[model samples]
Target chain A: MWTSRRRTRAALVVAALSLTALTAACGGADTAKTAAGAAGGKGGGAVLKIKDPGNSGPLAVAKKEGILEKRLAEVGATVQWGGSYASFTATVDAVRSGSINVLEGAISPVLGYLVSGKDIKIFAFTDPVTDPAAPQTDGLVVKPDSPITSVKDLVGKQVAVNKGGRGEYLLLLALQEAGIPADQVKRVYLNPDQGASAFATGKVDAWWAIVRAYPEAVAKGARVVVHGRDLKDQDLNMQAARTELLTEHPEVVRVYLKVLQELTAEAQKNPEKFQNVFLDQGPTAVSGPRLTDEIARTRYAKVPRFATAADGAFVTDVAGIFQKYGVLPTAVNPNDVIFDLKPAA
Target chain B: MTLEKVPLGVPASVKDPVEASVTSVKGPPKGLTKDLANDSANDSANDSANDSAQGFAKEDAPEREVRGGAGATALEPPRYLGGRRRGPVASTAVRVLVPLLLLAAWWYGTASGAISSEILAGPGAVVGALGELVATGQLGDYLLASAQRAGLGVLVGGGLGLLLGVVAGLSALGEELVDPTMQMKRAVPFLALVPLFISWFGVEETFKVVLIAVAAASPMYAYTYLGVRGVDRKIVEAARGFGLTGTRLAFGVIIPTALPNILMALRICLSVSLTGLIAAEQIGATEGIGYLVTLAQQYYRTDYMVLCIVIYAVLGLLIDLAIRGVERVAMPWRGQVAAR
Candidate 1:
């Protein structure tokens, strides 16, 4: 016979199970409903579900100031701030699943996803950094005491690079410029953390450090062999939105970029605060003076523009480079991936 | 008192009354001393007897001169398992010394320029950064979020695991139905399931939680299943003989006996749930300690990175302490011995 206590326990368990089942069903429906179009809020207005990059960048500034929300409201569209993603590439998978509809990131890594039949489109992009004096987003580095000084010297040496990423691409470009065979240089593929370790411990002769790594390596007395500035026009910071969202609500895309540009310009006016957005909330690897110097020397900050079709040419060359390096499994048509959000004159 | 000078196990009948004063002695037979009491032959696994002997050993020296005290032919026959317990002060000093030494080494390395600030921030910098996190209230928010995820994941996962384990352990039909499938699921790495889960559930709170749940569940199920199966069959028979049936027999008889192992499973589940936390929060987490790590990594903040590591290490220590507390409360019948 069932006791009252046991019955109560059973009832709680059943209740929990039912709640879980209902939640899972609701979530499944949410993915489908939001995947086909911009998410409609309870008030029947478009909700642009996007990951607002926090702690740094124009996106971070925009998020902090609610620029997107305020601007998009003019078009009956509201901005929904989802948290940022760790992996730029993983956000592509998120976009495909309709977990998010807009992704802002460095575009090189995400090419493979686009090549492999993901329906995402590059609607806007920051024009390439042309000035050689600009702060290089990433660079190849060596120990201060190491014998290697140039890309030519790196031949036959083990250099750690993030495979199929900007690091490897930068190294490839450097090797090409140095007139050395890419196969001659031993590429030790590793993630940033592992690469940092390998470089510090002399496990690898060189490390291709990216984003935060470049500035940090310079602080740690790592001598740079080459950075993105020394290479070609591959350093295009781009924004992409899903085709469904682009079609259903073009105004959301326009307002988002417009507000982002305005806010980015506003942020750059106080470059010190803008760069130090993290403040004491965390520790930065670079020292105070080093960051200030880099900020001073930084000649350009890429403000994104609605990409025209001409922007697709550089992407085509990058795809060729990716193909040559065997980053992508097969070739993809650049035309299919580039969708113009800017109206032609 | 010199125990080496005393004789042991000598019979009272063999000695004259005047010659052997301790022969007729009751508790600590007169000549018994600490060293002689705790011989290798008397070394006991159970510590209670030793505690009792030690209690009697603490007696003050007698003011009355020993006409027969030293003349006792035999020592107390009670064997002792003796080890000197370190004082709390000494124990705490030893604990404090380790991290201090490491901190000193780190300070020296950084101060002397052997360690670069880029590779690792100085302990002072990390403390400042930690203070910064606290001041901004980021730590509290991140910590609460992480705790909620781990706690809820453990509850849901651990509950399901316990139910399955009980069913499998009690009934052959249940084992045949559930065990093979669970075992198969166990072989698949939980990290590998992240992408699949994102596609299935989408990268929402559900995916993060369910991923943690899945990770927390497996160890729990395995341990619970093993614990239940290992419960004493004789006790189950006895409970059944006493007219207990179904849930009563299992819960009353089996589960109590199996509680130790289940507690161990909880410990493991709690620990590994952190692993799933890292993987889950990487996708689209806005809040949590993992988010701190992600931002730190992205923005190149080594201080915050090190701070996050310290947070994880501290969390691990706290979890272990919590489980130990649970063990003490739940298993009071078990003897308390200093873990080696």
Candidate 2:
């Protein structure tokens, strides 16, 4: 009886091994489907790989209209998208590795990357705060009924901020202006998602809430007790590129910027109509009206201005800040790192 | 012709010596002629070393009697340690050496850009991360927490499983009672129970421990049940002839001989407990190797992730070694095997 059962078990093992082999044989069907989808377009041979670290509404719009794809294609280029939970770090890694030529993410990580001696330069501004739109996505948010009414009140309190991005820099600027030393505040470093959870439970005294989380916090009874406008002269968001990729692939860089200009123009005129593009492509699920309101709130049309030496200077200044804060090495030069914009240069 | 040799074989050792003596009597063969030609090639290395160290060695040749086994045996070396056996040693060495070598390769590959650093971590960064974790004392705390949870999981789950499995396997009525339930229980994946477990137990340390225990229970049940039921019938017949009957017959005759199977069940339970704790840690724990890995990944610290994984692998090996040690102690007749 035992001998018969052992034989049966041996046969079962063999059958299982064969079944696993058969499953592997059918695994490439998904990859083939992706290829078939790609064949629907024949507009360009040059593929322009563009990545957005954040869940930006504009990206969904571009994806919906296929305008970013079409515009790049017309210039003999194609575009691919990459998303990240820690968008700033993802963008920094992408640029450092030359995997992506352009980054449409926040500015802090770009500063951190430059400070870390990576050859990334802020080629254009994507989101910036101006006079009319005083309170953009960048702000210090606190839970309801918290005694932390002002940035000065934040001394010795735990504040959650996404490390190595604009959020960190904005908080630093807020602290600096408040005459609170950076070390005085315990910065609980967490991603936006984690920060949302931390802030909800009172685990964090305050959070540098951005975009969806900012509004989500507001809906959840958290108040934006402080704004980025309160911190004067800040560089909010940037469209950066690796210096090597920009210099070597000048035409590709120009084509990418030109596409951005078209995207900006479309966004400025019919902001609501283009809301679906970013809504579909971004990480977060945002309604069209909400996205339109979000974009309108940023007044991004003025921020993604033509790439200039002043943009380069601001990047250098941000790099200096990163070094001063000891997040980056002190000896690094910003000028050597920033990719000199061809038209601006 | 040589292949057709009739059964005239003598001792092979004597044949080889005689043949070698005959070959020497031939005053060197064609192979010797080749060696003669390459003598100069061999001589150069010997001559160069001699020339370099010619006057250096003899002066103070510290007449140090090589202290053999210098303070070596504080603990007596086992005649045949279970862990030092060929199978276990090879498993240990392969398990450890492969990961270490892979880590070294990963470090070298990424730093040298053989593999892009964006995708794979370099060794220096991983080591630097390990150093950071050590300095912060994060690694030790996570390991201890995970180990304690897994140990508790095995003890509680294994005890319950042993009781249920033995009772169910012993009687026809008991088998019928648990048969359908055991079948259904085995079908449920441990992770699916996490939500229900959390609701009942909350996301506290108890919840994590209970989840691991529950995950461990099914495998232990199957192993112990099968072991008890599958005990040789002849042993039971002998116990019956000796007037041992009822529960006494089952416990005395059945469990004693099925002791190997029970030990094996414990081993299975221990391994499954470890696996369950990892899943528990992954979802909602504040501390554990899995949670540490999640933290590292979130912060983009690939090195820390690698370090945590290495520590987990080491812990698993230690668990297996401990199980084998227990197995040896429980079954003293089966002496330890020699190392390969």
Best by DockQ: 1
User: How does model 2 fare in lDDT?
Assistant: 0.60
Off by over 4 Å in 1: A1-40, A278-280, A284-287, A297-299, B1-120, B336-340
Give a tens-digit lDDT track for model 1, residues B1-340. 3333223333223245443333222334333323333422222211223333344433312312343466665533334324466899998899789878987998999888899877888888788889988887878988999888887778777777777776676666667887998998889899999888988978877787788888987888887777766654545656666887655566666677677678888989988888888888888888887777876776666778888888888888888889889878887755443222
Query: Could you estimate the TM-score for every candidate?
Result: 0.80, 0.46
Itemize residue pairs with steric clashes in candidate 1: none
> Cα RMSD to native, each candidate?
9.2, 25.0
Q: What is the Cα-based lDDT of residue B196 in candidate 2?
A: 66
Write model 2 residue lDDT over A144-260, tens digit each, in one string.
788989988998999998786666777887888778899999988888767876777678899998655676566556778777766664565667776665666667667677766
DockQ-based class of model 1: acceptable
By lDDT, the best candidate is: 1
Sort candidate 2 into its docking category: incorrect
Could you tell me which 10 consecutive residues in candidate 1 chain B have the lowest summed lDDT? B39-48
In candidate 2, what are the lDDT values of residues B53-75, reduced to their tens digit?
Answer: 22112211221112224654353
